[model samples]
Target: SQKIEQNSEALNIQEGKTATLTCNYTNYSPAYLQWYRQDPGRGPVFLLLIRENEKEKRKERLKVTFDTTLKQSLFHITASQPADSATYLCALDPPSGAGSYQLTFGKGTKLSVIP
Candidate 1:
Protein backbone atom coordinates (compact mmCIF):
# COMPACT_ATOMS: atom_id res chain seq x y z
CA SER A 1 0.00 0.00 0.00
CA GLN A 2 1.08 3.55 -0.65
CA LYS A 3 1.28 6.04 2.19
CA ILE A 4 2.05 9.74 2.53
CA GLU A 5 3.11 11.57 5.65
CA GLN A 6 3.64 15.22 6.59
CA ASN A 7 4.48 17.00 9.78
CA SER A 8 1.61 16.53 12.21
CA GLU A 9 2.68 19.57 14.18
CA ALA A 10 1.94 23.12 13.25
CA LEU A 11 4.76 25.25 11.90
CA ASN A 12 5.21 28.82 13.05
CA ILE A 13 7.53 31.33 11.42
CA GLN A 14 8.18 35.01 11.49
CA GLU A 15 6.97 37.12 8.63
CA GLY A 16 9.56 37.54 5.84
CA LYS A 17 11.21 34.24 6.69
CA THR A 18 11.29 31.07 4.65
CA ALA A 19 9.11 28.08 5.57
CA THR A 20 9.99 24.59 4.50
CA LEU A 21 7.60 21.62 4.56
CA THR A 22 8.35 18.00 3.94
CA CYS A 23 6.34 15.18 2.39
CA ASN A 24 7.40 11.58 2.58
CA TYR A 25 5.98 8.51 0.93
CA THR A 26 6.49 4.80 1.11
CA ASN A 27 5.51 1.67 -0.88
CA TYR A 28 4.84 3.48 -4.12
CA SER A 29 6.54 5.37 -6.89
CA PRO A 30 4.63 8.27 -8.31
CA ALA A 31 5.11 10.04 -11.60
CA TYR A 32 4.30 13.47 -10.28
CA LEU A 33 4.42 15.36 -7.01
CA GLN A 34 1.98 18.16 -6.25
CA TRP A 35 1.58 20.80 -3.56
CA TYR A 36 -1.65 22.42 -2.49
CA ARG A 37 -2.83 25.03 -0.04
CA GLN A 38 -6.05 24.74 1.91
CA ASP A 39 -7.73 27.29 4.07
CA PRO A 40 -10.19 26.57 6.82
CA GLY A 41 -13.40 25.09 5.39
CA ARG A 42 -12.04 25.35 1.85
CA GLY A 43 -10.77 22.78 -0.59
CA PRO A 44 -7.17 22.41 -1.50
CA VAL A 45 -5.89 24.70 -4.22
CA PHE A 46 -3.16 23.55 -6.51
CA LEU A 47 0.10 25.38 -6.01
CA LEU A 48 2.79 23.48 -7.92
CA LEU A 49 3.52 20.22 -9.60
CA ILE A 50 6.87 18.61 -10.34
CA ARG A 51 7.61 15.60 -12.45
CA GLU A 52 9.71 12.73 -11.22
CA ASN A 53 12.46 13.72 -13.57
CA GLU A 54 12.51 17.29 -12.37
CA LYS A 55 14.69 18.14 -9.44
CA GLU A 56 13.05 21.44 -8.54
CA LYS A 57 10.42 23.94 -9.64
CA ARG A 58 9.69 27.51 -8.67
CA LYS A 59 6.88 29.99 -9.03
CA GLU A 60 6.85 33.41 -7.54
CA ARG A 61 7.66 32.97 -3.83
CA LEU A 62 7.13 29.20 -3.87
CA LYS A 63 9.41 26.31 -4.76
CA VAL A 64 9.12 22.52 -4.84
CA THR A 65 11.55 19.65 -5.19
CA PHE A 66 11.08 16.00 -6.08
CA ASP A 67 13.59 13.30 -5.25
CA THR A 68 12.67 9.85 -6.55
CA THR A 69 15.53 8.17 -4.80
CA LEU A 70 14.34 9.40 -1.44
CA LYS A 71 10.65 9.14 -2.23
CA GLN A 72 10.24 12.58 -0.79
CA SER A 73 9.27 16.11 -1.80
CA LEU A 74 9.97 19.43 -0.19
CA PHE A 75 7.89 22.60 -0.50
CA HIS A 76 9.27 26.00 0.36
CA ILE A 77 7.76 29.43 0.73
CA THR A 78 10.07 32.44 0.61
CA ALA A 79 9.40 35.77 2.33
CA SER A 80 6.49 34.44 4.23
CA GLN A 81 3.59 36.65 5.28
CA PRO A 82 0.66 36.32 7.62
CA ALA A 83 -1.55 35.94 4.60
CA ASP A 84 0.34 32.77 3.79
CA SER A 85 -0.94 31.03 6.89
CA ALA A 86 -2.74 27.85 5.92
CA THR A 87 -2.50 24.10 5.72
CA TYR A 88 -0.18 22.83 3.02
CA LEU A 89 -0.65 19.40 1.54
CA CYS A 90 1.39 17.20 -0.74
CA ALA A 91 -0.22 14.72 -3.10
CA LEU A 92 1.03 12.13 -5.55
CA ASP A 93 -0.68 10.19 -8.25
CA PRO A 94 -0.37 6.51 -8.64
CA PRO A 95 2.48 5.28 -10.77
CA SER A 96 1.87 5.06 -14.47
CA GLY A 97 -0.33 2.20 -15.66
CA ALA A 98 -2.21 2.04 -12.40
CA GLY A 99 -5.38 3.10 -14.26
CA SER A 100 -6.31 5.52 -11.56
CA TYR A 101 -6.33 9.29 -11.47
CA GLN A 102 -6.64 9.35 -7.71
CA LEU A 103 -3.94 11.03 -5.65
CA THR A 104 -2.72 10.13 -2.21
CA PHE A 105 -2.47 13.12 0.09
CA GLY A 106 -0.63 13.84 3.28
CA LYS A 107 -2.45 15.07 6.36
CA GLY A 108 -0.96 18.55 5.75
CA THR A 109 1.20 20.87 7.81
CA LYS A 110 -0.35 23.98 9.24
CA LEU A 111 1.73 27.11 8.88
CA SER A 112 1.40 30.33 10.84
CA VAL A 113 3.36 33.43 9.95
CA ILE A 114 3.47 35.87 12.79
CA PRO A 115 4.06 39.57 12.37
Candidate 2:
Protein backbone atom coordinates (compact mmCIF):
# COMPACT_ATOMS: atom_id res chain seq x y z
CA SER A 1 0.00 0.00 0.00
CA GLN A 2 1.18 3.51 -0.84
CA LYS A 3 0.19 6.70 0.91
CA ILE A 4 1.12 10.36 0.61
CA GLU A 5 0.55 13.02 3.25
CA GLN A 6 0.91 16.78 3.18
CA ASN A 7 0.51 19.33 5.90
CA SER A 8 -3.15 20.06 6.49
CA GLU A 9 -2.47 23.34 8.21
CA ALA A 10 -2.87 26.68 6.47
CA LEU A 11 0.49 28.39 6.32
CA ASN A 12 0.04 32.05 7.20
CA ILE A 13 2.91 34.38 6.44
CA GLN A 14 3.71 37.91 5.38
CA GLU A 15 4.63 38.86 1.88
CA GLY A 16 8.24 38.51 0.62
CA LYS A 17 9.13 35.41 2.62
CA THR A 18 9.72 31.89 1.46
CA ALA A 19 7.09 29.29 2.21
CA THR A 20 8.15 25.69 2.65
CA LEU A 21 6.04 22.56 2.76
CA THR A 22 6.61 18.85 3.08
CA CYS A 23 5.27 15.65 1.61
CA ASN A 24 5.78 12.20 3.07
CA TYR A 25 4.91 8.69 2.07
CA THR A 26 4.99 5.15 3.31
CA ASN A 27 4.98 1.60 1.83
CA TYR A 28 5.49 2.52 -1.79
CA SER A 29 8.14 3.51 -4.27
CA PRO A 30 7.13 5.81 -7.08
CA ALA A 31 8.67 6.22 -10.51
CA TYR A 32 8.40 10.00 -10.28
CA LEU A 33 7.02 12.86 -8.25
CA GLN A 34 5.02 15.95 -9.19
CA TRP A 35 3.85 19.11 -7.46
CA TYR A 36 0.73 21.11 -8.21
CA ARG A 37 -1.08 24.22 -7.07
CA GLN A 38 -4.81 24.62 -6.69
CA ASP A 39 -7.16 27.46 -6.01
CA PRO A 40 -10.51 26.99 -4.35
CA GLY A 41 -12.82 24.75 -6.36
CA ARG A 42 -10.33 24.45 -9.19
CA GLY A 43 -8.18 21.72 -10.67
CA PRO A 44 -4.55 21.49 -9.78
CA VAL A 45 -1.98 22.98 -12.12
CA PHE A 46 1.36 21.24 -12.52
CA LEU A 47 4.30 23.13 -11.14
CA LEU A 48 7.23 20.76 -11.15
CA LEU A 49 8.23 17.17 -11.81
CA ILE A 50 11.23 15.19 -10.60
CA ARG A 51 12.26 11.69 -11.48
CA GLU A 52 13.32 9.13 -8.93
CA ASN A 53 16.91 9.32 -10.08
CA GLU A 54 17.08 13.10 -9.97
CA LYS A 55 17.77 15.08 -6.83
CA GLU A 56 16.40 18.62 -7.21
CA LYS A 57 14.43 20.76 -9.65
CA ARG A 58 13.56 24.43 -9.88
CA LYS A 59 11.48 27.03 -11.67
CA GLU A 60 11.45 30.83 -11.53
CA ARG A 61 9.84 31.28 -8.10
CA LEU A 62 9.62 27.69 -6.96
CA LYS A 63 11.98 24.82 -6.11
CA VAL A 64 11.51 21.18 -5.31
CA THR A 65 13.79 18.52 -3.87
CA PHE A 66 13.19 14.81 -3.74
CA ASP A 67 14.93 12.16 -1.65
CA THR A 68 14.04 8.59 -2.52
CA THR A 69 16.01 7.30 0.43
CA LEU A 70 13.89 9.36 2.78
CA LYS A 71 10.63 8.90 0.85
CA GLN A 72 9.92 12.60 0.98
CA SER A 73 9.67 15.75 -1.12
CA LEU A 74 10.03 19.41 -0.22
CA PHE A 75 8.32 22.31 -2.00
CA HIS A 76 9.32 25.94 -1.61
CA ILE A 77 7.78 29.20 -2.71
CA THR A 78 10.09 32.19 -2.61
CA ALA A 79 9.01 35.81 -2.16
CA SER A 80 5.54 34.72 -1.25
CA GLN A 81 2.60 37.06 -1.81
CA PRO A 82 -1.16 37.22 -1.29
CA ALA A 83 -1.64 36.07 -4.83
CA ASP A 84 0.56 33.08 -4.00
CA SER A 85 -1.94 31.85 -1.43
CA ALA A 86 -3.31 28.55 -2.56
CA THR A 87 -3.24 24.86 -1.81
CA TYR A 88 -0.12 23.00 -2.86
CA LEU A 89 -0.40 19.35 -3.72
CA CYS A 90 2.26 16.67 -3.96
CA ALA A 91 1.60 13.71 -6.19
CA LEU A 92 3.35 10.44 -6.96
CA ASP A 93 3.50 8.25 -10.03
CA PRO A 94 3.02 4.64 -9.10
CA PRO A 95 5.92 2.26 -9.63
CA SER A 96 6.25 1.19 -13.25
CA GLY A 97 4.03 -1.57 -14.67
CA ALA A 98 1.25 -0.96 -12.21
CA GLY A 99 -1.11 -0.51 -15.16
CA SER A 100 -1.45 3.29 -15.18
CA TYR A 101 0.75 6.34 -14.86
CA GLN A 102 -1.90 8.51 -13.30
CA LEU A 103 -0.79 10.49 -10.27
CA THR A 104 -1.96 9.91 -6.73
CA PHE A 105 -2.02 13.18 -4.83
CA GLY A 106 -1.85 14.17 -1.22
CA LYS A 107 -4.68 16.22 0.25
CA GLY A 108 -2.44 19.30 -0.03
CA THR A 109 -1.17 22.04 2.23
CA LYS A 110 -3.03 25.29 2.27
CA LEU A 111 -0.89 28.44 2.03
CA SER A 112 -2.14 31.87 3.06
CA VAL A 113 -0.31 35.14 2.61
CA ILE A 114 -1.18 38.22 4.63
CA PRO A 115 -0.48 41.58 3.15
Candidate 3:
Protein backbone atom coordinates (compact mmCIF):
# COMPACT_ATOMS: atom_id res chain seq x y z
CA SER A 1 0.00 0.00 0.00
CA GLN A 2 1.71 3.15 -1.26
CA LYS A 3 0.79 6.63 -0.10
CA ILE A 4 1.71 10.21 -0.98
CA GLU A 5 1.44 13.21 1.30
CA GLN A 6 2.01 16.91 0.86
CA ASN A 7 1.86 19.90 3.16
CA SER A 8 -1.93 19.75 3.38
CA GLU A 9 -1.94 23.35 4.56
CA ALA A 10 -1.66 26.78 3.02
CA LEU A 11 1.76 28.40 2.96
CA ASN A 12 1.76 32.20 3.17
CA ILE A 13 4.87 34.09 2.10
CA GLN A 14 5.99 37.51 0.95
CA GLU A 15 6.56 38.24 -2.68
CA GLY A 16 10.05 37.70 -4.13
CA LYS A 17 10.78 34.92 -1.66
CA THR A 18 11.36 31.28 -2.22
CA ALA A 19 8.70 28.75 -1.30
CA THR A 20 9.52 25.13 -0.68
CA LEU A 21 7.04 22.29 -0.50
CA THR A 22 7.54 18.70 0.48
CA CYS A 23 6.15 15.44 -0.86
CA ASN A 24 6.65 12.12 0.88
CA TYR A 25 5.63 8.61 0.13
CA THR A 26 5.66 5.04 1.40
CA ASN A 27 5.53 1.44 0.13
CA TYR A 28 5.68 0.89 -3.65
CA SER A 29 8.14 2.35 -6.10
CA PRO A 30 7.09 4.73 -8.84
CA ALA A 31 8.42 4.90 -12.36
CA TYR A 32 8.47 8.66 -12.44
CA LEU A 33 7.43 11.76 -10.54
CA GLN A 34 5.60 14.85 -11.80
CA TRP A 35 4.70 18.21 -10.39
CA TYR A 36 1.65 20.25 -11.39
CA ARG A 37 0.18 23.63 -10.72
CA GLN A 38 -3.53 23.82 -10.09
CA ASP A 39 -5.73 26.86 -9.69
CA PRO A 40 -9.01 26.99 -7.91
CA GLY A 41 -11.68 24.81 -9.51
CA ARG A 42 -9.40 23.75 -12.36
CA GLY A 43 -7.33 20.77 -13.39
CA PRO A 44 -3.63 20.64 -12.76
CA VAL A 45 -1.14 21.83 -15.36
CA PHE A 46 2.12 19.91 -15.75
CA LEU A 47 5.20 21.64 -14.43
CA LEU A 48 8.16 19.26 -14.09
CA LEU A 49 8.83 15.56 -14.49
CA ILE A 50 11.63 13.53 -12.94
CA ARG A 51 12.36 9.94 -13.63
CA GLU A 52 13.49 7.39 -11.08
CA ASN A 53 17.02 7.60 -12.46
CA GLU A 54 17.10 11.36 -12.39
CA LYS A 55 17.96 13.41 -9.35
CA GLU A 56 16.47 16.74 -10.28
CA LYS A 57 14.48 18.62 -12.90
CA ARG A 58 13.97 22.32 -13.44
CA LYS A 59 11.68 24.63 -15.37
CA GLU A 60 12.03 28.39 -15.36
CA ARG A 61 11.72 29.51 -11.74
CA LEU A 62 10.71 26.08 -10.53
CA LYS A 63 12.90 23.20 -9.36
CA VAL A 64 12.08 19.65 -8.31
CA THR A 65 14.27 16.99 -6.76
CA PHE A 66 13.52 13.33 -6.45
CA ASP A 67 15.15 10.97 -3.96
CA THR A 68 14.19 7.39 -4.59
CA THR A 69 16.12 6.23 -1.58
CA LEU A 70 14.00 8.39 0.66
CA LYS A 71 10.83 8.01 -1.35
CA GLN A 72 10.33 11.74 -1.45
CA SER A 73 10.43 14.81 -3.67
CA LEU A 74 10.88 18.47 -3.03
CA PHE A 75 9.42 21.29 -5.12
CA HIS A 76 10.75 24.83 -5.03
CA ILE A 77 9.50 28.14 -6.39
CA THR A 78 11.92 31.03 -6.44
CA ALA A 79 11.17 34.75 -6.62
CA SER A 80 7.52 34.06 -6.05
CA GLN A 81 4.74 36.47 -6.88
CA PRO A 82 1.04 36.88 -6.25
CA ALA A 83 0.32 35.30 -9.60
CA ASP A 84 2.39 32.30 -8.55
CA SER A 85 -0.01 31.55 -5.72
CA ALA A 86 -1.73 28.25 -6.35
CA THR A 87 -2.03 24.67 -5.18
CA TYR A 88 0.92 22.51 -6.17
CA LEU A 89 0.51 18.79 -6.62
CA CYS A 90 3.07 16.00 -6.81
CA ALA A 91 2.13 12.84 -8.61
CA LEU A 92 3.81 9.49 -9.09
CA ASP A 93 3.36 7.25 -12.06
CA PRO A 94 2.52 3.77 -10.93
CA PRO A 95 4.84 0.98 -11.91
CA SER A 96 4.46 -0.02 -15.53
CA GLY A 97 1.79 -2.53 -16.56
CA ALA A 98 -0.85 -0.82 -14.48
CA GLY A 99 -2.71 -0.28 -17.79
CA SER A 100 -2.54 3.51 -17.69
CA TYR A 101 -0.22 6.49 -17.69
CA GLN A 102 -2.30 8.44 -15.23
CA LEU A 103 -0.68 9.75 -12.05
CA THR A 104 -1.51 9.44 -8.38
CA PHE A 105 -1.31 12.90 -6.82
CA GLY A 106 -0.86 13.97 -3.26
CA LYS A 107 -3.45 16.11 -1.49
CA GLY A 108 -1.41 19.16 -2.58
CA THR A 109 0.04 22.20 -0.86
CA LYS A 110 -1.63 25.60 -1.19
CA LEU A 111 0.67 28.58 -1.52
CA SER A 112 -0.29 32.22 -1.01
CA VAL A 113 1.85 35.19 -1.96
CA ILE A 114 1.61 38.45 -0.07
CA PRO A 115 2.10 41.81 -1.68
What are the lDDT figures for the candidates, one per model? 0.93, 0.89, 0.90
Maximum-lDDT candidate: 1
Using TM-score as the measure, which candidate wins?
1
Q: In lDDT terms, how accurate is model 3?
A: 0.90
Alpha-carbon TM-score of each model against the true structure: 0.96, 0.94, 0.92
| lDDT of prediction 2 | 0.89
- In what order do the candidates fall by lDDT, top score first? 1, 3, 2
lDDT of 2 at 3: 93
lDDT of 1 by residue, 8-103 (tens): 659999999999999999987798989999999999999999999899999999999998899889999999999999999999998789898898
lDDT tens readout by residue for model 2, 1-115: 5799886667888899999999998877787899999999999999999888888899998999999899999999999989999999999987678898677889899999899
Model 1 residue 43 lDDT?
97
Better of 1 and 2 by TM-score: 1
For every model in order, what is the number of clashing pairs?
0, 0, 0
Residue 36 miss distance in model 1 (angstroms):
0.5
lDDT of 3 by residue, 9-76 (tens): 78999999999999999987798888999999999999998998999888899999999898999999
